[model samples]
Target chain A: MTDMLPTGATIGILGGGQLGRMLSVAASRLGFKTHIFEPGANPPAGQVADRVTTAGYDDIAALEAFADSVDVITYEFENIPTTALDALEAHKPIRPGREALRVSQDRLTEKDFLSGLGLKVAPYANVESPDDMASAVAQIGAPSILKTRRFGYDGKGQARLKSGADADAALVDMQGAPAVLEGFVTFTHEVSVIAARGIGGDVACFDPGQNVHKDGILDTTTVPANLTASQRMDAVLLAANILNALDYVGVMGVELFVTQQGLIVNEIAPRVHNSGHWTQQGCTIDQFEQHIRAVAGWPLGDGSRYADVVMENLIGDDMDRVPEITREGNASLHLYGKADTKPGRKMGHVNRITPRQN
Target chain B: MTDMLPTGATIGILGGGQLGRMLSVAASRLGFKTHIFEPGANPPAGQVADRVTTAGYDDIAALEAFADSVDVITYEFENIPTTALDALEAHKPIRPGREALRVSQDRLTEKDFLSGLGLKVAPYANVESPDDMASAVAQIGAPSILKTRRFGYDGKGQARLKSGADADAALVDMQGAPAVLEGFVTFTHEVSVIAARGIGGDVACFDPGQNVHKDGILDTTTVPANLTASQRMDAVLLAANILNALDYVGVMGVELFVTQQGLIVNEIAPRVHNSGHWTQQGCTIDQFEQHIRAVAGWPLGDGSRYADVVMENLIGDDMDRVPEITREGNASLHLYGKADTKPGRKMGHVNRITPRQN
Candidate 1:
């Protein structure tokens, strides 16, 4: 029986980005406290949480103290060091467990897991070394992508292959690190389905969102995704299946590509996602609240929307146009407490809610 | 004209109850830093804010330093001394300003302002001394309430008089302090309209909430109030008229009694009102956020709800049922980080949103 946590329990979170910040807000709204563990000088989540452990990920004593302080452990980002998780697991439960991380840390392993679940995936091969790279590329063919798999986010750690000469150069550029060669798909659009699973195995999903990315980062996510009814059903079923198979006890995002042929898996994020930010304004219970409920051992709220929504990320300099956007439409502006607006940084987002009726 | 008070500006908040706590959350959400100013050692609002200024209200040095550090000053409760407001106003602006607080702090003065606007109010009189008590009671009625005209909340600082014999005793019991005697209303129901006036004189009101009170404190507020379209129209008009009269900038909650005669004014809070907590889940922008926007010189957001909502306060030991309440329905729960929950104290509230088919 899952009886370790109660309503007033404190949940430990790693990483202090907007996801963690939103997670802390959601946790408080549900009678729970969140203690954020972040390495930086100041994490955005620290501004609104009960407590914060400001120590590097490798600081064992800090990690030990953090583990001693919280009831259970969860993370906002998946790139937390394996050793850190191993040490924390000695004391508290880490939901979506370390096994899920092992399966997802490497691109080759992730694709294998998706194929094992009988899900559609891009043709992929493991690039063990530069010597074996040419043969692997020949099998996967040109116009493929070479990805490091582990610790890659926002289009980093991945190289695109366009021709035979480019394959060897990409493999050599990767420097013998274990990589995966994924055949490129001619997809019409990209979408993500965010779902959650409670400890009791109860599952709920938000409507899928059609996402547009620029410079390899999320730009906009529109709900009521441009998908056929059957295709939307397939996305939810796929997300739930992934959560169940991993025994996940929180929210997870499943990103996929919609092509003329069918749905192809792109990636899996085992936490609250950016694409679901529209829920804050459009739905009764949002993804962050749903994630908190699942992990806190409470029943999930109804995740139904009363309006159609469009959420646009205010990346870096885009934040300067908040006044203009506010004047243009009845949009809700959310700016993160970031100190410097450097290039490629996520500054904030704006949510525009429209009546369902045309 | 509104420049330099950007996202990272710190706001100094006086009082640290649930109102201050919610204001701190909303302030942090907009990338603004909040520094809570309260005399107590531990206040719930401190848990989420950036800093806490623990000093006596009259400590002019601490107050000066606090005002110097923050861009502006605001408070949760309206009973703050005029001297403190004077000292702070010398350094920074006070939103909704001191005039609004002075009027709302004195019940007799508040009634004058409302009556000046031709709004309906219970017949009242000022009793400055025991010599005038009998005349004041006779002018109002036998079944009238004798209340101190200043600094009263949650059934405190007042006594009720049912007959002529008891009227003298009630007047003596109040120690010959300044008081108002009001004829009791046999109202059909009670409701409140929470409205806001931005710095640019923009006015917006949430749907009026039908309220229930226990021990003269708000117990629950149900939206999609049991009011006819005409009544709703009157409520909005009354609130807007008050805003224009006061030249107010920030949220205001007006308590009203729906009597057989007509709508009668009960009381008015010049800041974010407790009865409006439902706006957090029911609307795209909550009253707290709207107030922050008005004070910060940002454009107001849409204060419209897409669904009907019921918000119930969790007072004192009622917080013990938080786990059960959170699991029973699609309720969004909010708990203040108070260490002790004394009797009749508001520890938090829960909002249940139920979409209406109109």
Candidate 2:
């Protein structure tokens, strides 16, 4: 039957963070159970999920056991080790596949894949060694960001090089790994299109929201972002093409750089994303539930927005303001159970929904 | 600092049904863990919760351990034995308390309590024995019901006395137990108010919805309830008064019968009610989350309805329609993990959100 995931069907998810926690909540709403496997210290997802296996990323035995328990498997984030994927894929259906992982895990491959899709990306050069770094610096010039080709997340594992003299230290910092020096682009704004694609190839997108970062961490996202109507349409169209191209089945957060010419793809998160948190109070379906529905092979839910939204992350001590934030009638507070409130950690968030009905 | 219950807090839930399941889901959302203590062989809440302790209803040792691990306690259904509650109350904070449970679990007590609050109730009489039943039958007459004073639910342990001959058999069927015989009132419609009150005495009521029952099981609930403005005001007033009287701290569903005389109080559910499931898709705060917020000592949410709604339960084999039900653009489906779907068992429910602004 169409959009019917049989009862007792299990959905395996990789990465056990807030994304997985929210995903598990959504999966339960649709009659599917989520089994989360994450190699971390009691990830939040473990709390709400039906089952969880805490094993290191390269632990093939645990990965295989996890894969065997579920009907379909999806990941909360890119950068899952290829070996882990190889083992999981052998036993379960992994949506978005090795190709989506291969491309999005590294900036260089991501750019190349997008470029292959005839999308515009910033100029770049690979730095394999000091010699290659020197030549790559000569080609890409000053003010380029030298980034390790893998394992970088949330602005970590990269160094911005303003001159050639810093090349040696940058390469040494990267520890003899292959890297890319990408030319900096002057962009109008940073925005992301949080979208989902069903296995049957239907795609739905939330309107692009302007994102602002503080110290390389997402600080806030406001809907009705400073984009022309055409730009919004362009973002959805581009996201749908990529989802179909990769045959991706799940919600993806497509970060894009809005330039004067058009939108340039930034990166893609193959799960429910932070930027779409507004959906919790602003839309017919939240991104996490939407993602679960897609991966469970269920029909995509209505993605219509009911309100103009402003979402602010409750970082570290900001969680202390939860009582105050939630006291406002318009705010929808969501807290992720993190034990320690260390600085810069995303402890929770609040979405203030103001209906645009008037 | 205000509502944060320390880390590793275990929230103990008494009844392990879907309300508990959904509550566990919300509790998990806030980083709080759950331990489901149930007497049933299998509890739907146990499927997604962190821990489950299955034992007899009167097992004091099991109840004690369940309470020991939990920071705060709550129950899904109102029928917790007073002895079991006494054991639990010795260890943890049981929100809504034994008084509320005692009042709601017995139809006689519930009706009496509402009547004491000056709320309108159907004419009623207590039947403690067959002789008491006969005397009450003389007063209440035919077309009334004889309900066991305790441990009755979903039309179980209740019998309709259509005539004097049936009255003796009804009391005999009631098995010499304490019972309540009520005069039947002709009603134009049935409705219920799903509301919550916080420890601080904050009261929030969702608009009452008209309910329809098939074979004594709730079949559907439509919000706006076809109640006139005065009727809606009366329903909310009755609900608020009930919460205040009980000093209740959680979501409660108060069923009402609207007759030519006015709205008559039917019964109350001390926890999330099936009739209130529409809140998931209709309101900013669903009953499950509203109950959590109340028990957690947080401020009550707005409980704002975003749209008109209709909720249908997927009882027993009715769950087979999930595929077709979910395909509707507006319905939100919720299913429990029951290994076997038996006749008369509630497997799940679906909420249909009608197209309207909040």
Candidate 3:
């Protein structure tokens, strides 16, 4: 790839939340300035970024100016407006590419794409209308999840169908948006591999982190996840396959379900994942820096875990524990400079670290 | 201590250099915003900091405005002007306080302070005139070094006397500036103890790092320094003693010489030192973050080293090796966002890490 971006290049980032804030810090560490394109006023990313353009993604003039100013464009979150990408792509390269975003933006497409690769994914069917929902319920059966195919995150835009009797209510919950009915996988645990693909096609994956969710949001992620040696290898190989298939460049968070049959693809986020936050304390190169390196066309860093870490998200009221957490010497606190602490908001995270066992 | 300054409190940093840049990044990590006060345009720290005020320290009105804007004041460099501190002291508390600056700003005062603390500093004498220089040489002997008492850094404003020859020329080199003559310690290796003092008088010290100087400029700092366990303890104890004596409220880098007699104090930096940069990759809590925590009146982090790290400085032309360094998976690159690369300028550093031995 064209002699890794020389020092002093500007990285244009979409979405100016905590992820963008951390990414901007990582970019600055690598001698790159960041220009945050955040529609919101006084974004957290703006506090650390070199520049911030406070304009909506639909503002073509602002988008063009941002694209023109940066050497490369990347996003902290998926579901970027298509028009924004169109405007940005004409000006600079967007790492992770449009294909990754296109496939992962919708639940149905992501499942179909994973299934197409001969990867095991939860049994799923697309649902558009009431008849389609009935048909999906018949095929996927009860105890399935009905979710909007796009722009859904956390527990939002989703409903659980305990039985075929709840199909009508589940479908209504999708609010007429194109939806997917996914049969729940009988899994032992949920784990995520934070992997990166360089411009040269080299791939590296951090050790999978065993995750727990509270209120459908990631609560904690612990490294040295309970896995056989073979399972660990399978996780890395599968993540690499997905990155390669999409011709991806930059970091990706691949969620997987460990079932008795095999590993099932849960989902993929085309950016740094909350589950990977432990890497900041456990590894030499963090996920944010790894993403920046890939987007900058530099060689991928070793994702080897040097320490065992447990990362707990400080969501909303969880921030009240800051005083106590701050006094915990082993805990490395990372607070997102968000002013408000409304319920369910990710205010920060703390990574408690310990030496790894041989 | 003052409830830890609360999140989002602004930290006013004097001297917008690489140290300030890293400190600002650390402050941001802790949810604290940083305002950089710099006389130069587009300083490296300003690129990452939330705010930048471009004005000389002597500007009383600007200083007052900056002091009013920040909740607390701290500095990156020791040679802060007296007038600036006088203007700021009324509006905000400066951590590490005036005593650190008062002693460290002059080579003579620093030596006297260290010696008064029962620390073994090099044999030294103050030089204000030719008579003093002549007396110093008569008492301390030949092959000693003469350095200006103030404003000397990175081998600048220094002269060496060999066999008492060129004494007149060495004195002339001072240009009437107050100077100090020091007898060299017959040491085996140079090491630095990076120590921090919290607001509650709690002290934590990282293991000493073996440092190598290239032409009086630090080139590399490797952890697990060549020292006996007893010597290591002494280093930490002496460092803590210095902090306690000053009633220090921030990180200090204590340079020492391992001599046949014992460890001798070389000097101490009142702020984060370049030698401690390796902690960014080697420890869970790095020196920069430690400094931030101390200055912010938060509990000091555990200064535990989890990995053995060799940090190599990327000085000016050394940046040409960045591409090669980037390819090294074990290397964690930290580049200061410097636009220009002049000879003798520190552009960046790379921390090469390996798991520590049991």
Which candidate tops lDDT?
3
lDDT ranking, best first: 3, 1, 2
State which candidate, 1 or 3, has the greater DockQ. Answer: 3
Worst 10 residues of 3 chain A by lDDT: A1-10
Instruction: Point out the higher-scoring one by lDDT: 1 or 3.
Output: 3
The sequence of per-residue lDDT tens digits that candidate 1 reaches over residues A1-358 is 2452665678889888889988888887665678999999778898888788899989988999999999888888888888899889998888767877777777778889988998998998888887667787789888888988577899888889888789877877677678888899899999999898987888889889999999999999998899999999999999888888888788888999999988999988888999999988887778998888877777776677778899999999997886676554457778789888998999899999888642
Residue lDDT tens for model 1, B4-77:
25887888888877798899889887888888889998677877777888988799999899999898788899
Clash totals for all candidate models: 0, 0, 0
Question: Of 2 and 3, which scores higher on lDDT?
Answer: 3
Model 2 agreement with the true structure over B301-346: per-residue lDDT tens digits: 8887767888889999898787677567767788887778898998
* Candidate 1 residue pairs in backbone clash: none
lDDT of 3 by residue, B65-154 (tens): 999999999989999989889899989999889999999999999999988888899899999999998899998987889999999999
Residue pairs with backbone atoms closer than 3 Å in model 3 (clashes): none
Q: Is candidate 1 or candidate 3 better by TM-score?
A: 3
Q: How would you class the docking of model 2?
A: medium
